[model samples]
Target chain A: GAGVSQTPSNKVTEKGKYVELRCDPISGHTALYWYRQSLGQGPEFLIYFQGTGAADDSGLPNDRFFAVRPEGSVSTLKIQRTERGDSAVYLCASSSGLGRNEQFFGPGTRLTVL
Target chain B: AQTVTQSQPEMSVQEAETVTLSCTYDTSESDYYLFWYKQPPSRQMILVIRQEAYKQQNATENRFSVNFQKAAKSFSLKISDSQLGDAAMYFCAYRFNQGGKLIFGQGTELSVKP
Candidate 1:
């Protein structure tokens, strides 16, 4: 079975620019999540989607960060006016359902904002 | 708020030896999930083991096992018969049964020696 996949393994952008990262969850997975990992730090939750709607997005750092899962299988994380501080690995994961289920993660998209 | 901690920044073990990685988490919730994820150089996060807060018995998978102490809020991973392929970054994560988001700790880089 195909596992979760992310597009643009690496992206480098200038500050103030807009960026979008994509994630394709495993088939039949109803729960999707996004996280950001800075160097030397653990992954921090950014957003979570149970289906087409976001179930929880409190982890999003600021208003500039937004995510969406329209059809429930694929998701996109959008950043407005990117900042250098946004440089990090953006990880995507999916699970069969929520609550205690093991999540399968993608390789992650490394975004470097200059 | 939940916080996971991995005190050891790095650890090394000889092949065929045993090594344990420490992890401690703080959560107000009574029921939750703990996990250990391994990320090799490829940067793909792989699930190692998981423990449920209500279960008294520890979780084990092959040479990978966890010593989960609910009272102590401790979840440690022990790897026996270590192999070179085991070299990677290990992260301890926590997720509440009510929410789908995962809170991760700073990772420990494991170096398996031959």
Candidate 2:
């Protein structure tokens, strides 16, 4: 079975540029999550979608960050006016559902804002 | 606030030896899940093991086992006969029963010596 996957394994952008990172969840997965990992730190939750609706977006750092899962299988994380502080690895994960289900993660997209 | 903490920033073990990584969590909720995830340089988070808060017995998989102390709010992972492939960044995470978002710790980097 295929696991979750993220596109453009690496992205480099200018401080004022915009970038979009995509994630393809596992088949039959109902829950998708996004997390950000800064250098030398653990991953911090960003947002999660249950089906097509975002169940939570509290982890998003600010208004510049947004995400959507239109068909419930693929998700895109968008960042506006990227900053140097936005440089980090963005990881995506999916699970069967909430509760005790384990999350399967993607290989993460490293975003570097110059 | 729910938070997970991994005190060890780095751990090293010789091949065929045992190494234990410590994790502690603080949360008001009683029902939740704990997880250990591994991330190598490739930057993919892989589920190593999971333990449900409602279960009293510890969880084990192959050479990996967790000493889960509910009363102490501690979960430690012990890897027996550590191999070089086991080397990676280990993270402890907590997730409430209601949501799919995960709260992760600061991760511990483990290295294996041949």
Task: Judging by DockQ against the true structure, name the best candidate.
Answer: 2
lDDT string for model 2 (A76-101, tens) is 99999999999999999999999998
Report the C-alpha lDDT of model 2 over B4-113, residue by residue, as the tens digit.
99999999999999999999999999999999999998898889999999999999999999999999999999999999999999999999999789999999999999
CA lDDT, candidate 2, residue A46: 98
Question: Candidate 1 chain B: minimum summed lDDT over ten consecutive residues — where?
Answer: B95-104
lDDT of 1 by residue, A17-43 (tens): 999999999999999999999988899
| Backbone steric clashes in candidate 2, count | 0
Which consecutive 10 residues in model 2 chain B have the weakest lDDT in total?
A: B38-47
Going through the candidates in order, what is chain B's TM-score?
0.98, 0.99
Q: What lDDT score belongs to each candidate, Candidate 1 first? A: 0.94, 0.95
Where is model 1 more than 4 Å wrong at Cα?
A: none
**TM-score of predicted chain A against the true chain A, for each candidate:** 0.97, 0.98
Worst 10 residues of 1 chain A by lDDT: A94-103
